[model samples]
Target: MFIELDFQDNGKQSNYQAISTLAQLGYDGVVFSRTINDVITKNDICTFKELDLKELDQNENSSFKNLSSLTLMKNEKKQFRQYSRLNIIISSKKNIFLLKKMENILKTYDIVAVFPQSTEIFEKCIDLPTIDIISFDLSLKYLIKIKYKQVNKAIINGLFFEIRYSSMFKTKQSQARKNTFSNAINVVKYTKGKNLLIASGANDPINLRGPYDVMNMATFFNIPFNQAKNILTANSESVISHGVMRKTYFGVIKVEDKKKIPKELEESTDEDEDEDKNKEEIEIEKEEMMIEKN
Candidate 1:
């Protein structure tokens, strides 16, 4: 299923509208991201709490008209899932400490992404398993060069690189657009298209694009058509899967699987048991022969 993993709530549009647009464009899921600063601010917290209370009260209303239209859309033939993520923009060592303190709360979200503002922060983030995506500010290219070693290490550690297409359209300046394109190409080059994810990062419905349209746009960065397609589909799915795994116990135990084990896997398990049994028997026979000789 096609997914867009970064939709910012910028007050220009309601999440319901943005999600409706995404569903219409054939997206199966959209992750709504809120920056750490916004989430931590007192005013924002109060506002969000008020809104939450209002929504809860509305839900209690018996009238069907008071129900969220998004619920109806979800029940439709094409199902759309909405997920929430917390994006931490790490700039200072102090911010890292703050994140450590808030890490437990952050883990409550479906995904937690880190946007490192400096090379030092980026290096530290490469080793952080809690952070799913290393999101760069794709609006402009920074002076710091990202080394291939760091990107490769992150890939080995199961961290994904995120490129937001919405940043390119946010600006009218040609130079900003150039910088965005250049930074994206540099990231794609360093990562070698492995563990690379392309997302809308859209703040409004107008900025969102269809899955195929996003694939076409990705090719502009010299990415192969097949790889670009995977960025939207397979790679994005992997990111979500990793996010889901992160919140589980040791990133291994998902909800207990109810389905029967595959025949091939069951057969392999049986074969492994038989091999162990035969090795034990052979050792026992060798010991017996040695005792007789003695």
Candidate 2:
């Protein structure tokens, strides 16, 4: 299923409206995230178990109740999956050390993302085990530089780099749009298109696009066709799975083995036994007839 890691209800629409729209647009799952400033403290990790969105309690405002009350949201129509994510914005070097301090709290969520304000802050947190996704404010006047060495290290360590396409759509000014494109190129160039995630970061549901449309936009980064497909499908799954792993007990997760077994090696049932006996008797009769003829 294709997953979008960034989504928030920005007053233009309720949480359910945005998610329902995403489901209609062919997104199989989404990450509803809450952003935190500075070091996360006092067990502020806001994540929950997966549940059906249709089963939730409704408020007078005609929206799903407080987001903190739920962790997972599913829609039966598309079997759409919803999970919570936590984003931490790191603006200073000192905040990097605080990650280790709140390591336990960070693991409680299904997804954990970090936005580095500067290149220096990014380097310090590149190897952090608590982080699952790394995002940059590419629309800013002063963009964070993406270096191959650092991005390679992040990829090697199972970290996903995010590209928010909705940012470009949000900005009207030519300079901001130019910054978004320039920074996106830097990110795609250094990462070489591996472990890259494409998200809308969209508050307005209109900013969201279909999976194929998003994949097509990736061609602007010069990514190959087949590899570009992974930006949304395979890579997104890996990021979500890794995020779920963070919430696991010591990094272990249970998975089913669906490999097909050969029919020749399977045991026969009662009907097969009857057929086999008839075939054996026929073979014995044939052998006796041959002897008589001889």
Candidate 3:
């Protein structure tokens, strides 16, 4: 499923009206991004559940069920596959190590993202394993310089770099647009379009576009054609998986009695082994194909 990871909030609640529009534009899900301060005064977790929304189920267990009271349309609520994301603001150098202290707090949200305002903050945030995504204020006229070494290190550690196309296309500032293009080009240069997530960070419905349209526009940032599709598909899915795994426990817990195996253990299957093997082969094949094509 194609997921839009960034949508600015209206007041304290998510704008479901705008999110419903995304469903018509070919988006399977939309992530509501909330901004939090440096200090953790409140450990509020995301109310929306993190169930896989590939097949639409509008029941109580539905991922978007939490938004029922926010909007009156019963049919529109299930049309959205929603997840709550927390964007931690890192302004000063001292805030770099804040993740270490907020490990428990971080577990509450479905996804945790950090936006570094300065080079020092960016350098530190890239190495943080607790966070799923690393992004910058690309819409700014003066953007942060992206280094290959840092970008490579982040990718190696299984973190995604976000590209918000919604803001870039809607902004009237020429310098902001130029900076977005230049910064994105430098990012695609280092990572070569791998481990990058393309999202529509739109505040309004007017800023949203179809998934393929966003993928097609990504080439303007110098992303390879094949990899651009993965940015919206595989790469975005990786971020979602990393986010859900942040606080979830998939392993079995040992008990005193050997005969009494927990239901979790009994239900476990090795079906994922072949799937993992296939994924590795597919990824390597894509890399080889892109290398040969280039």
Report residue 215 deviation for candidate 1 (angstroms).
0.5
Model 3: what TM-score?
A: 0.71
Clashes of each: 0, 1, 0
In the range 1-294, model 1's lDDT, one tens digit per residue, is: 788889886542266566557766777778877786412322222122111222422443343223343455546754466677778777763355445444556567777788888887787677565668988887765735688767776786789998888877777878778888888888888988999988877787788899889888889887988888888888878887887777664334223243543343333344664565466556656865897999
Angstrom error of the Cα, residue 15, model 1: value is 0.6
lDDT of 3 at 76: 57
- The CA lDDT at 120 in model 1 is 71
Arrange candidates by lDDT, descending.
2, 1, 3
**What's the TM for model 1?**
0.71
Q: TM-score winner among the candidates?
A: 2
Q: Whole-model lDDT for model 1 versus the true structure?
A: 0.70
Candidate 3 clash figure, as a count: 0
Indicate the TM-score of model 2.
Answer: 0.73
Selected candidate, larger TM-score, 1 vs 2: 2
lDDT of 2 by residue, 184-279 (tens): 877888887888888888877778888888878778767676777777888888998887666574334333233432343233254764565466
